[model samples]
Target: MNLGLKTAVAAFALTTMALTAASAETRVTYKSAKTGSSYYQMGVELAEAMKAGTDGDISVTVEESQGSVQNVMEVRARGGDYVFTTPPALVGLAQGGKAMFEGKGDPAFDEIRALFPIPSLTMHFVMSADSGVTDISGLAGKTILLGKGSFGATEGEKYLDLFGLTDQVEIADAELSNAVAALKNGQIDGFVTAGSYPAPNVIEAAASTPVTVLSMSDAQVAETKRTKLTIPAGTYAGQDSDIATTSLPVVAFTTTKMDDDTAYALTKTFWDNKAKLGDTSPWWNGVDPAMLSNIEGKIHPGAVRYYEEAGIALSDAQK
Candidate 1:
């Protein structure tokens, strides 16, 4: 080969190597809830924080999803690298392939790993005053609205089973917006949703109708306590008193496919900038350092390392 041709070839190889190295920085896609939901907003905030904290070493992109179940499926499909999910949905997917994942494509859910918990989603059983359904027990023979393909429906069914009202009540599945409209038009006696306090749909429904947030029976509350779930007082409009209800921890997780160093960096970035991220949503205000230890699923080795360095202990399930 001519000397000029050899020089050109070497230069081309060097350029290609540099470009590959530049593009090799970790890039993660985070699947969040629907556009207007709190989870979506939180995901955006977390992504931004990660980008800034990592100093461009990692880039996170946010993707909108239906909710917990969809988020899990997306991550499993390699559509995203991380997702926001609740314990019930994750456990459902992991345990028996039940709930929204029942009979769907097979995914190794056990391979999913937990990163951290954000906040708790309180279950709200809201009924119109005119429906005369003041508490959970009053829903017998009534049509109740549960969001279509939502974790809310799964939790609602569990509530029905606990109260033994499954057969006695008619379950109507609809989207949140549609469910709110149905509740306003008296098409449904009650609506069951689980999310952060002051959910916009619940607020809109309460604005249109005289609604009451039902409290769980003592027995029901006792049963839920085993899972460390609780609903605090005055979570929504017209909910003047404390309501006893179950809650599920909202956790961020990733699959085992994610590299240990990247997961460690992402986890550290989130917690290290918790104060800054808290300003993005009211949910973050409730984030406690201790909650990091209270997550489900196997903790990613990377996250486990970061937590250990930060002096946070992992729960048996997380370990």
Candidate 2:
């Protein structure tokens, strides 16, 4: 072969390599909640934060998820670049192979890792009428629909057990999607739901008919080992006073399949840019570094690296 021809072939190979390297971009799929929900909004914000934080080096694709259960279920079919959010307790149930995960356990759940807490899943025990029942105990002797297989359902039932209302309250087996209509029609006395406050369904229920947002006492909140939050009066139509409640902390999670570098970048971007996100969203304001204590599973190594560099204390689970 002529020397000139060999030099030309080498140049072509070098150019091809340069192009491949330049086009290399890390892509991640962030699945959280259904479209039009606050969680979905967070996903979008976080995606933007990731891109901006990395100067467009990393790209995130936000995908709508049905719910946490559906999000966790997809981990079995997802690859390393997949990330999702859920209440930390749900991850515990998944690991233990309990609740909806019963008889459906797989090695995939074991690979689940925590990223960071977004916000607490505040429980809203919305009643159809202003029954003057002040706290969770009011469920006694009332027919309540707690839904099924959701973080809300399990956590709500736990509250019922804690408050000793299990035997006293009649639990309906109806679908939660129709809970608002049922409440308006007087089909059930009330229902228990856990989500960010001012939940859309709760608002719709309050607007459609007379409603009450019951409050839990401080003692009840302490007993639940969850966070205390108050839904201030006027948050809903005709609501007259603040309602106390407990909330289950929620966290973003990923599988161990994600590489440490990508995990670190995602976590770092969130912490560095969260203040900017908070400027436009009230939910981001609720998150803090201390909430790391609430994450139940192993923290992703990449996120761990960021926390360590930032001098954030690691939770016992993470350490």
Q: lDDT of each model, Cα atoms only?
A: 0.76, 0.85
Off by over 4 Å in 2: 1-24, 98-108, 127-130, 137-191, 201-212, 222-243
lDDT of 2 by residue, 1-319 (tens): 8999999999999999988876777899999998987789888998988889888878999998888889998999999999999888888898899999999898999999988889677888888764556567677888899999877899989988988888999998898888998888878999888777667778888899988888888888899898787777787899888888888788989999999998898888889888998776656866889889887679999999999999999977784
Worst lDDT window (10 residues) for model 1? 224-233
TM-score of 1: 0.71
Output the number of the lDDT-best candidate: 2
Q: Kindly state the number of residue pairs that clash in model 1.
A: 0
User: What digit string (tens of lDDT, one per residue) describes model 1 on residues 168-259?
Assistant: 99988576668778988889988999777656678888888889888877787776553444444555666777776677767788878888
